[model samples]
Target: MTTDASQSQAHTSAKHLYQRHQSVLPDWLAVYYADPIELTHGEGRHVWDAEGNKYLDFFGGILTTMTAHALPEVTKAVSEQAGRIIHSSTLYLNRPMVDLAERIAKLSGIPDARVFFTTSGTEANDTALLLATAYRRSNQILAMRNSYHGRSFSAVGITGNKGWSPTSLSPLQTLYVHGGVRTRGPYAELDDTAFIAACVADLEDLLGHVRSPAALIAEPIQGVGGFTAPPDGLYAAFREVLQERGILWIADEVQTGWGRTGDNFWGWQAHGQNGPPDILTFAKGIGNGMSIGGVVARAEIMNCLDSNSISTFGGTQITMAAGLANLTYLLEHDLQGNARRVGGLLIERLRAIAAQLPGVREVRGRGLMIGIELVKPGTDEADPDGAAAVLEAAREEGLLIGKGGGHNTSVLRLAPPLSLTVAEAEEGAAILERALRSTQF
Candidate 1:
């Protein structure tokens, strides 16, 4: 077939698939680009569409592909474990599950840590909430403004991001606090020191007005909230107050865990003054695209529940094997260090490009997780349309990226696999520079 003929056929195939998707899927389930591409397979940091078009994948399936696409070790482990058995439920003694849990527990930094696996980040956060409320005997909870934990009913309640939270009704009484996003809130004008003090004072005042809350849940770096984060040590200051009230601190590391932030193994480690959080929830990346979510907490908090609970599919042998292998690759190769080095170069490149664009409001985040906020040129107002145009332009340039924010989805989120090479970073950044230029107001 001629090249043009093949391209036409691919377009038709994608159109047909999109029509079918629209007919069956929920309306709220959004897909990228005006014309969505069906990804058939991926290797390393690149993915091929069903149309045979190749693009550098900078988002890494929302940062779940921690190491790289189709990593050999993980593939082998999953294949071998599947050949033996897929699942035996939590009722059985699952060796892979136990092994991963042991490794995570030791690395969790929580004293006498215990790990419980779930299927997704949402489930992991749900479990943490369960433990917190049960142990503290209070349903009131403290959460940072513009935060996102997960999509479950309980998780939604605690989610401060209006874009993600669908309903106001919740099982727990969640009090939204300040200081999650350092660039947009009332404290935005304050310096790092004053910002921390203002946010801490606000927390103290909020606590005085309400009953003692079960726990204060926050992401070290707000993921779905456009990768925004408070100044380092802000959480540590809050910890001191929460500690005085015997309130537990839960770090939701769904997007910030496993060294994605580069400088620290866990996001909370950036604020290590209070030791570790009482409970920590993680998912995405540990299994390198496999469904593996878990919560790690001190033994006392993990064991507070009186009733027995088991996640039937959470720690299946196959998924656990994948997680173990993926994690092994991540640690053995020091992918975290790679993220620190490569991501540093990438961010600096982005900032230099952004300086030339008036619409680019801010370039922020750490390690591999980064966000570029778009706004109206010479104005502080968010420019969602500008962000959308850049996203489409990047796609046209053979690059795949993501967009996210709290009220307006105007922040471009870039979190490639930790194993991303410097060459790939440069290539993606070059494409992104052109994309940003294309979208200039």
Candidate 2:
């Protein structure tokens, strides 16, 4: 096929931009592909690259685009709010902020819940750490193995993943806990009952040795750790123990919030028997690409701070308007129900394909969030090269995907928009199957 001149020019522009990007940006920013293609625009679940190639977007900008690309409602809300006023700090009364906060408090399921908005998940979690340590008067914290909280210093101290954690210098003392990743840890070989018992016992033992921790922070499903998760009710069991010790529980729902998991609105609901978390941090999907993040907690914990604080950019008018509109559309459409139905079918289709692929060590996830772990044929050793090859091959087939894991980073991550259609799921799976086949031994 002969390419159009305009498309050819676009490709050249992309190359030129990439060179400028590399020269100016940090080296660790990490981009996909050997020859990276700049995405110019998107609509719904598809995006067009610089070379006029349209690809099915499965990652959704790391699951930030929860609803869809270029959603008219959100666009309209943002435009209207921007035209009126963009930045009015938290020093004064913000009606849009109050309205959105009220909606989130009721939906949060925490009794007498209070909300504090932030600009990103990192800030939300950082605020939580501040609340917990101040309330408990201890800098010690408990975190699960193979988990990622955020990028801030306090966030990194609690982050269990070495890949994402950039430094060991931190003000807080962190104790790594078990039960985050069930299949790869020492408790992996045990049955569900035994595994839960073992992890709880380890937690108790760990607590006996250290000072009382301010909180136990964890992600229900390790998002950046390759979509891995412990068995259902694992955190519930941990909660029982922590409750006895007066330790608070913090649920970081950054990637798992807003009905992405299908079965539960928040990822922590899968382990809700112990009651809602003492503090919950959320971002990413809630804003649907707008920069909105926050923490919800009971008034007791949220009001414990004696000193005053405020976020200069948090809970601004425009982002709040976008959140209100996006949340309204999401609830009206019952995207959670759609995620359950469509995700169920998509997982089945991927499982069927994985059965025929030797490199696919495991296919795991819930709802719209799914992952495919790659290995060296029959061996259990991770095959990161195979993952990269499959990623490139899928791009060639006009499909976009992502990669994540613990030690070796060998799992293909898939978290498309929650409103993805069944036809789109089928198409993505077919392209992935071809990509996987190309990586065969």
Give the best candidate by TM-score. 1
Instruction: Please provide, for model 2 over 113-215, each residue's C-alpha lDDT reduced to its tens digit, 9 standing for 90 to 100.
Output: 9999999999999999999999999999999999998999999888888989999999899999999997897999999989999999999999999989999
Global lDDT of each candidate = 0.94, 0.93
For model 2, how many clashes?
0
Candidate 2 structure lDDT:
0.93
TM-score of each: 0.99, 0.98
Candidate 1 lDDT tens digits, 112-206: 99999999999999999999999999999999999999999999999998999999999999999999999887889999999999999999999
User: What's the residue-level lDDT of 150 in candidate 1?
Assistant: 94
Among all windows of 10 consecutive residues in model 2, the one with the lowest summed lDDT is 1-10
**Alpha-carbon error at 71 in model 2, in Å?**
0.7
